[model samples]
Target: MNALSHKIIFFLFKLKLLQPSESTINFWLQSEDTDKLEYAVTQGNYKTRKLAAEALEQLAKPFSIPALLKCINDKVQNVSIACLNALERISTKDELIKTIVKKRFKWVNEIREKREKFEANKGKKYNIYRWERASKKSFDMVKERLKRPIR
Candidate 1:
């Protein structure tokens, strides 16, 4: 979009005349503007913020670290997870976030291992209960981390 159109949208958005839309997230993703993507991370709705976080992760811009760090505390579980994943990708120097990412990957790998061993090997009954419990446990652990700001 032209600069004038963007300015108009920002004006309307600031006046509370327009709700944040997924289209704006798409715009930021396509434009690859780190500042605008950061704004979306800070200001967009839950779903919009989630998409913006994923987009920033894909872009992997170093400057977006501060914005992603702030977004990791979003009230929405998915948004917080998305921000955490983005930080995992963008902040290589942060050992703590990297460790968290490793833990998350371990949980995922364990789930896949269980599925393969039970379902693929013996063709036995799928243990949906166990999978659900493990999934929830992992989710709650991540959610607990979301309750506080990441350093």
Candidate 2:
């Protein structure tokens, strides 16, 4: 983090300046250096990525999807949430959304099932049963309704 970058991060954090215009966001989105923008997506700083994610909605070109998907692995929960929102902004078709949702459902199901088992072992209910059910539904939908294109 450079001095100027640190200053901007601090200022944005302290003032709760959460939204930036499309052009201001483009400054970062279009820059040769993506380190700062990548950092914002992964830093666990909600307000920063909250702004960046909104900007991502507008700055999206073909190159943005993979980078935005990378955010889903962020250690911060909110960053992952923001990445999902950003995906929604970029996805145009039901299939693309469905594909991503299917992937997310797989992840959520694996995680939630393990957590649920752990909770059950400890004689407690889990917080994610609803999500587990939804994941199952999505999985079924993908398996049954998502027919492959005819050759």
Candidate 3:
């Protein structure tokens, strides 16, 4: 990796945002380095894993999608959120973004449907609790995202 790359990586590392060198990133993208890439995805520190996810999207490699998907369920919410945001950057790669959108839409729709069904079955009486609170929080996030100024 060049000095600039190292500096950037180090800065992000300090921020707990990324790990791995640029060349190491390229090496992970190479076919023969699949094992290393997979290991990096699983064993890398949060930043490294984040970088790996971004690299996979940049490389437009379909093989890395599964790993990226796994990141969506990561223990760290930041990692999972970053993985979702990276999916938007990778959306230009044919099925990549479409697949993620489809899955997320399905999940959101299922949640909405279930919520509606429950509300209907309950009939007239209204109670607010965990699931409703979570749903409201999710709606607020969506609203916030929608209201974001176009970059």
Instruction: Compose the digit string of candidate 2's lDDT tens values, residues 23-109.
Output: 444566665335445545544256666666656655554456777777766665555666777777677664776588568757866
Quick one: best TM-score, which candidate? 1
Scored by Cα lDDT, where does model 3 land?
A: 0.64
**TM-score quality measure for candidate 1:** 0.58
Q: Write the per-residue lDDT of candidate 1 for residues 1-151, one digit (tens) a residue.
A: 6656766775676676764566665676777877877877888778778888998999998888889878766777678778888988888997876886677656656866997787777855665654457888999999999999978
Candidate 1 Cα errors over 4 Å, as ranges: 1-3, 100-151
Among all windows of 10 consecutive residues in model 2, the one with the lowest summed lDDT is: 16-25
| TM-scores, all models, native as reference | 0.58, 0.41, 0.41
Best model number under lDDT: 1
TM-score-based ranking, best first? 1, 3, 2
Query: Clashes in model 1: which pairs?
Result: none
Candidate 2 structure, TM-score to reference: 0.41
In angstroms, how far off is 15's CA in candidate 3? 26
Which runs in model 2 stand beyond 4 Å of their true positions? 1-7, 10-39, 42-64, 94-98, 124-151
